[model samples]
Target: MSSNLGKIDVEVEVKSPVDKFWNGIRDSINLFPKASPNEYKSIEVVEGDGKSVGSVLLIKYTEGFPLVTFSKEKIESIDEANKTLVYSVIDGETLKYYKSFKGTLTVIPKGNGSLVKWCCEFERANDEIPEPQIIKEFAVKNFKNLDAYLIGA
Candidate 1:
């Protein structure tokens, strides 16, 4: 890692199967806003088909959500066989603090359930800025909430 780069890895256990969790994440542009309207207002594809690599999405957060109001994200990679997806922030309020921000999500089968791992890589715009702990916390909470929603669905 570079001197200016910061990384965060968080894992949450889910009652859903690995495939189910992976599918849900792949479809998050629709599911996230529907499942947690308080956190996400909407996610829409701005470029390409939302399913494949190179798709760009604009994500709007709810008014009172912390840190950022919206983000423009580009899908960098998708490995369905490995249940991994990688995306990078291209534009947003987050860009004011980060020179670059990328996230990888992977779902792994664990016994009867699954484990969702979220990894974030970011470069701060300046030394005075804090690490992206809020983003990590948001991801963990989102995973828990989405897991519960999936189980009930």
Candidate 2:
């Protein structure tokens, strides 16, 4: 990584099947707020059909979520065969501290469950800015919550 760039990878092992977990992530616009209403206020597609590359999603975080009020992310790529999705923060309060930010999510099959991996690549605007550990924690929490939701469903 570059001097100003940072990368973090977080993983969560869940009881939900790989297919189920991957499906939930792909349909996050509808299931995220339902699974964790306290964390996500809403997620709406502002561009594209919410299913393809270049789709832009506006994600609103609930009050007291300890992060930005909202985020605008653009879908860069999706590989269904590999069960991976890549998105970048194009416009959001996160940009205030990050020169650039991108995230990639992948789901892998495990014994009767799934292992979800989240990788965040970010460039800080200044050295004083902290690494995005909060975001990584949030991703781990979201995966666990989503896993519960998928298992229940």
Candidate 3:
């Protein structure tokens, strides 16, 4: 993404309040599919328990006609102190395009509510990187979906 600019950031807030969002993050393994809906139609454990470090998840996204399979995530580090979860694409079809994918999600509470700060940096295995719009769309969509889910909860 030589032509791409600096880091992109997206913020989402739900009406259910901060506690509900934090709860969803805490029980992410169990609530992911439910919270994100069709983005993760199903998830299977690839290794380790779904809790703590070394846990791996394989998610199946619901693509209408063509099957667009991607990875779940390989947990690299989990810090409850910082309230952040770090993950990389260890196993996923998406890795073919992105040589390395690293992301950090932090859950923080604001004055009257809370939200999640999702950030990521990636490298292209090949010479091409995905268009910035696609990346931003994906990131924003995920936040919107999760925010809606939290409001429902």
- After superposition, the stretches of candidate 2 with alpha carbons farther than 4 Å from their true spots are none
Candidate 2: clashing pairs of residues: none
Residue lDDT tens for model 1, 33-104: 877889999999999988799999999999989879999999999999999999999999999999999999
Per-residue lDDT tens digits for candidate 2, residues 36-94, read 88899999999998879999999999997885999999999999999999999999899
Winner by lDDT: 2
Count of steric clashes across candidates, in order: 0, 0, 0
| Candidate 1 Cα outliers beyond 4 Å, as residue runs | none
Pairwise lDDT winner, candidates 2 and 3: 2
Cα lDDT tens digits, model 3, 126-146, are 556553346556666666666
Local lDDT at 75 for model 1: 94
Best by TM-score: 2
Give the distance in Å from residue 120's predicted Cα in candidate 2 to where it truly belongs: 0.7
Better of 1 and 2 by lDDT: 2
The candidate with the higher TM-score, 2 or 3, is 2
